[model samples]
Target: MSEKSENLVEIRHLKEYFNVNVGFFRSKPLKAVDDVSFSIKKGETLGLVGESGCGKTTVGRTILNLYKPTSGEIIYDGKPIKTKNDIREFRKKATMVFQDPYSSLNPRMTVSDIIAEPLDIHKMSPSKEARRERILELMGYVGLNSEHASRYAHEFSGGQRQRIGIARALAIDPEFIVCDEPVSALDVSIQAQVINMFDELQEKLGLTYLFIAHDLLVVRHISDRIAVMYLGKMVELADAKEIYDHPQHPYSKSLLSAVPVPDPKTARSNKRIVLSGDIPSPLNAPSGCPFRTRCAHATKKCAESMPELKEISSGHFAACHIL
Candidate 1:
C-alpha cells in the first residue's frame, strides 16, 4: 500500500512468530501477530483490544521495534524503518509506556534519575543543569511535583508510579507512544485519573497513540478507532462508535455483548453472547478461521479457507464468511 501523508505510523502484513521447543531438538512456530496491518493518523489514538494472549502486546512491541518482526514492514512518518540507525532515529520520535508501572521502572534509581534516563541516552540535554530542568518539567507534565523526584519508585503509590512512567515517556518529547495497558494494574479510581492525564497530555503535546488494552470501556473512552484481534489476526476494525453500535463480526458482537451496562434496565435486557470452548493455542491453530471452534455462525466454507479482512461498510472492516 502507498503511504498517506496524514498517517504517522503504518504497519503492513506484520507477523511475529516464536519458536517453541516441542521436543528434543525439535521446534515449532507459534504465531503471535499474524498478517496484521493498520495505520494511525497523527494525533489520533487507535485502540487495540483482544483477550489475553491474543498478541496485543506483541503488536505494540513489534511496532516499537523492541521485538524484531518475523516478517512485515513498519513505516513511521512516511519513512520505512530498515536499519539500526533508522531505528535509533525513530526511537527519538517514538516511545512506549509499559503495562506494569511497578516492574517497568527501576527500583534502585530515584524518580528523577528514571525520568532523565532517556534524555541521557539520546543526548537531548546538553548539561547537568539542563537535564535536571528537563526532568522537573516532565514530572510536572504528568502531575508530579519536584519534591517526589528524589524518592524511589518503590515508595510511591501505583498511580503515582504510572505518572512517573508517563513522565519518562515524555522526556524526549516523542510524537507517537505505544501505551501497552498502562493502567490495568491500578485501582478503578486511579485508572480514571491516569487515563484522563493521558488525554490531557495528548491534547497538549499533539501526540498520537496505539493504546493496547482489554477493557472495552477504557478503550472506547480513549480511542478514535478500535481494532479487534482474535488469535493473532484482526477480526474487525472501525470507528469506536461504529464498532460498538453496529458490530459486523460475530466475535465483535460477542465481545460487546459482555460489556457491563451501568443502567439496571439495560443490563437486564441485554443478551450475553457466550462463546463455547476455550481459545485455541496459537501453535496448533485451526486451518481457516481461528475462532471457528467457538463461532455459532461458522460453516464448512469458513473451515475451507482463511477469510480476508474486507470492508463491509463505510470505514468498517471484518473477516467473516457470512459478511
Candidate 2:
C-alpha cells in the first residue's frame, strides 16, 4: 500500500481448471480461468467485471492462493509465490473482502471476536489489552462503535455486516485487498455509503484493491482500470473511461452499451447490443476464443484458433480477431 510505482502483484498465465466427473470413471477438466495474465500496481484499483460464472471470483481467489491455481506463477513484490511458507508470508500483505457478508461472518462470535480472529491467528498483539485496542481501532475505522462490538453478526443489517467484514479484512493491515463485490448485496442507498467508505479507506490506508463486481456502474466509479472477462478468459482490459467510451472487443462493447444511460436524450440515441446464446459451460468451452459462440463478429478464424490479448491502444488491451 506504500506509494511504490512498481507492480504490487503480478499474475502470469494463471489457470484454474476443475475436474468434472461425467461417466462412471471418467472426468474432464473445466477450465475456470484459462491462461489469464494481469498485474496490479501499488495503490491502484483494478476492476474486474463479468457475468455470472465468468471466473471473476475465481481469479481473485486464485490470486490469494485460496484456490491453488493449476498452473502459472504469482509474483508479489518481486518474489515468486510458491509453497505454504510463501503463501503465509503473502497472507500478511494480502487479504480478501468477500461478496456475501451474511455468510462470511460467524453467527456465534461477537463482532470483536470476529474482527480480532486474524490478529489472534497472526499473533499480532502480544497482550490481551493490545488486542482489544487493535479491535477497537478497526471497528472505529469502519464506522463501528465499541458498543456494537459486543453484538453478534445476525444483529446487524446487511450493510453493517459488510462493514464488519471490511473491518476484519483491515485488521491485519494488509496492503492488497480483493474486494469481491463488497457492496453488491447491499441496498441501493447503502451501496453508495459503503462504496464511499471503501474509497475513503483506500486513500487513508494507502490500500490497493482488485475490485470485482457484476455492476458496471459501480466498477467504473471505483476502478482506475477495468478488465472484462467472458467464459474464463479476459477479453478486454483498459482504463475505466477508455473502456466506457471506446470498447474494442464485441463482448466489451456489448457490456458497455448495456449500462443504462440516465439522460433521456443519450438513452434514446444509444442502441443496446443484446448478445445471443447462453454462456457455454467451461467444461465444454469453444476451441478457439471462448466468446466466439456468443460474439457476432466471430468468424472461421475465431473458431479455428484462439486470439491473444494484445494491446489495441496504449494501455488498452483486448482479445479478438477483429478490432
Candidate 3:
C-alpha cells in the first residue's frame, strides 16, 4: 500500500449519457462521458484535463458513482462497485472535493457540523465526546483552529471554506479522493497553498487522487501522470512530464501548445497552435474520431473510424489515425 505498484482504481469502458430533449416528443442521448478508460495507482495523483464540456468532470462524477454510469464498469481496489452495500462501503474508502466551495458547503451549519457530516452518516465516532475530539483533529489537519468550529461556512474566506471542505472529505479517512477542480475557484495566490496542502495530506494519509482540472500548469505541477479528453473520449495519457514535453495526439498537442511559457525567450519562440473550429456539441458529435473535426492531421480514415488509444512509447498512449 505504501508503494505505487498496484492500481487503486480502474475505470473500464465507462460511459455516462444524459437524455436531452431535442424536439416535440423527441430526445437524444448527450454523451457526457463516452467509452473512457484509465486507472490511478495507490498513492498516485492522476490528473484528468481537457477544455470545458469535454466530459472531464463527468468522468470524475461517474467514478465516484455520484452520477451512475450509463454503461461500463467501475472497479475499486480490485473489486466491482456494484451492489448498494458495495457502494456504501466504497464511500467510506473514497470521497470527493467538489468544484465550488461556496455551493458545496452549507451556510446554515457550523464548521464543526459540516466536517462531522461524514462521520455522523457513517457512525465513525463512538460517542459525542469522541465526535467532538475527531472534529477538532480533522480541522487541525486542514489548518483550521478549534475556535473556528462554531463559525458558519459563509463567515470564512473561499480558501478557508475550501479547507473546511477538504477537512470534511478527510473525515471518513478516505484512501481516494476525486478532486473536481478543487482550486479552480480560489485566488491564484491561495491556489498554490491549497495544492501544496493537498500534496502534504496525500503524503500523510496515503491518499490517491483523480484530480480533474483544465489548468495545464496546475495539473503539470501536481500530477504524476496525465490524461487528456476531447469531446467525450480520452485522446492521450502518459507520464506528466512526457505528455507536456511530447504530446502525440493532435488535440493534446494543441492543448499543450496553448500553455503559456514563463520564460520570455521561450514564450517568444513558442508557436501558438490554434484550432480551426469550435468544439462540436456532444449531442451532435462528429462521426468516428471525436477530435477529427478540429484536428489538422485528420484524414478520410479518421472520419471513418475512431482510433483506439494504443501505447506508442513505453507507458505513453495516444489515439490518432495518423499515428
Candidate 4:
C-alpha cells in the first residue's frame, strides 16, 4: 500500500492503568498497557501476539476506546481520539468483533436484530425497508444466509455465530475493526473457515484490522506486520515475513521458536527456547526491562534502564540492550 494508505490507525505512547486498593489506605496501579505504540495501515492486518496477560487485548480495547486510556494518543485518519465527541465520531468509523462468539452476541436477540442494532444506532438507513435490505446485504457479505437471520444466537454453531458478529461490525460500514481472537474458540477446521472469511471480508470492504491472538501461526498467516509484547510493553514490531524469518528481541525469538513447524523434519531441527520463571504481575511489574529476567543475554544495564523501541532495520523495530 502507498504511504497515504499505509497509516489508518496510529497509536503513540499509549498507556492504560487501573487503580487497585491494596490494604488499609494502601493502593497501587496496574499498568495494563504501558507506552505501547504501533500503526495499522489501510487494507493491512497488524497481528498482535503474546501470552494471555501480556496486554494484547487491552491494546485493542484501548484503541477502540472501550477502556479509557491513562495517557498517550490514538490518531485515526489524522484526527486525535480523546473527547467523548471525538470517540463518538470515531465509533462510526471503527467497530469490533469480540473474542467469544457465544457471549459477545445477545442470546435473546435474533441474528437479524443483532446485525441491525448498529444500523439503528448509527441511523445509517433511512426507512425500515432500507434497514432490512442493509442488514441482509451485510449477512450475505459475511457468508451468512438470509434464511438464518430470524434465529437466535444459540441456534448457531461457533463459526456461524462469529459470522453474525462480523456482519454486525460491517453494518456500520466501518473502516477499522478490532478482531479480538475471532477464531480461537472454534474447532480447528472451523478456525480455518472463520479466518478465511475475515480475509475475504477485508479484501472486499477495504478494512483495516488489529487482529489479536495468542496463536503465532495464525497471526503470521494473516498479518502484513506483527507486533510482539511482553508484560505491558511492545518488544518487537516488523513485517510478517521479516519477523518470522528474523526475530530480533530475545522474547520474540522465544515466541517464534514455540510455534510448531508443520514439517516433522523442520520441527525436529528447530530449537525451542524454554523460558524459566513465571510472568511478573501487572500489579508490581519489574523495573526497567520486563523480559530481562528470562533473557539469556541480559546484563546489569538491561535491569538498570528500560530499552526504548529503536529501529533495527528499515521497517523493523526492537527493544533490547544487547541488540
Greater-lDDT candidate between 3 and 4: 3
Pairs in steric clash, model 4: none
lDDT of 1 by residue, 1-323 (tens): 44398999999999999999999999999999999999999999999999999999999999999999999999998899989999999999999998998899999999999999999898899998999999988988999989998999999999999999999999999999999999899989999999999999999999999999999999999999999999999999999999999999999999999998999898999999999989999999998988899999999988888899999998899999999
Local distance difference test, candidate 1: 0.95
**Candidate 4 on 1-323: residue-level lDDT in tens?**
36634689999999999889999898888999999988888889999999999999999999999999899999998778988999989999999998999999999999999999988887788998988899889888988889998999999999999999999999999999999988889888989988888899889889999999998988998999999999989999999999999999999999999998889999999999999999989898877999988888989998899999999999999999888
Model 1 earns a TM-score of: 0.99
Candidate 3 per-residue lDDT, tens place, 1-323, comes to: 44324989999999999999988899999999999998899999999999999999999989999998999999998888998999999999999999899999998999999999999999899999999999999999999989999999999999999999999999999999999999999999999999999999999999999999999999999999999999999999999999999999989898999998889899989898899979999999999998888888879998999999999999999999888
- Alpha carbon lDDT of each predicted model: 0.95, 0.93, 0.94, 0.92
**Backbone clashes in model 3, listed as residue pairs:** none
Q: Candidate 2 lDDT, tens digit per residue, 169-215?
A: 99999999999999999999999999999999999999999999999
* Count of clashing residue pairs in every prediction: 0, 0, 0, 0
Candidate 3's TM-score: 0.98
* Model 2: how far residue 106 lies from native, Å: 0.6
Compute the lDDT of residue 262 as modeled in candidate 3: 83
Winner on lDDT between 1 and 2 is: 1
TM for every model, in the order presented, reads: 0.99, 0.98, 0.98, 0.97
Q: Please state every model's RMSD to the true fold in angstroms.
A: 1.1, 1.8, 1.7, 1.5
Q: Of the pair 2 and 4, which is ahead by lDDT?
A: 2
